[model samples]
Target: MTKTVVMILFIAACVALGALSGAGNQPGEWYQSLNKPFFNPPSWIFAPVWTFLYILIGVALSATWYDENNGRRLVLFAIQAALNLLWSPVFFGLQSPALGLVVIIPLLVSILMFIAASWRENRAAAWLFLPYALWVAFATLLNLSIVLLN
Candidate 1:
């Protein structure tokens, strides 16, 4: 019962924190300014997709909690999450697609590193991150296209 509660809270907090990175700012304004790539998903798709991704991230984070008190992995996950949050404000709020592209590169690397680290400690948890890594990869490409086109 306690573990379930903990997982719920952990998922909620992580998703909230991630949401903070992209919360403010009117969508469609700056976003429409960008020359989105052909492959870019509709703007309406972001909210639902990110909501799902956050749930996955929550699960991934919870998986780490099972591996003893490994503060290092927690810190790594936090670092990546913070970067994930920052990308939105940089890209949309500030209207800096180039800067957003730069930001996501490190975020991508951090997530990859997190997956690598988790692989050593928990393979299942690392596997959960695979979708996230793939999404970031697509995001990176989309950002690059936006930067180049706009």
Candidate 2:
């Protein structure tokens, strides 16, 4: 099994799990209610953006998983993924942006560590997470806004 193949599997797992965790958040009800920041892209933008991001994450992890798959970076990759899953349900389903924001802090930190660690293992792979990191930063701001507005 090639490392790329393994990482692809892992990335696919993240997206599949993420979508499942978000199953309860109906777009009609949940998304329509939120007070999005002015900077928020059209609601339609999320799927594609995350889709691309998931691919990148997969490449990144697969690269790391390719290298050794037995390091702290690999573990952090998993941790960040778990954190990613929690954000959607917390914010959209429970309608608790505050708690979601709280949860995301650790997620954000985990991602940073993932990037740094992945960089040490594979610079290209680390770069793969850059968009995800940026998106999360944007989301943190957006989440803060939603909490404040609603």
Highest lDDT: give the candidate number: 1
Q: What tens-digit string does per-residue lDDT give for candidate 1 at 58-107?
A: 98888898787568888889889889988888887788888988899999
**Segments in model 2 whose C-alpha atoms lie over 4 Å from true places:** none
Q: Give Cα distance to truth, residue 8, candidate 1, Å.
A: 0.5
Which pairs clash in model 1? Answer: none
Lowest-sum lDDT 10-residue window in model 1: 21-30
lDDT, candidate 1, at 35: 70
Q: What would the TM-score be for candidate 1 when compared with the true structure? A: 0.91
Model 1, residue 122: displacement in angstroms? 0.9
Cα lDDT, all candidates: 0.84, 0.80
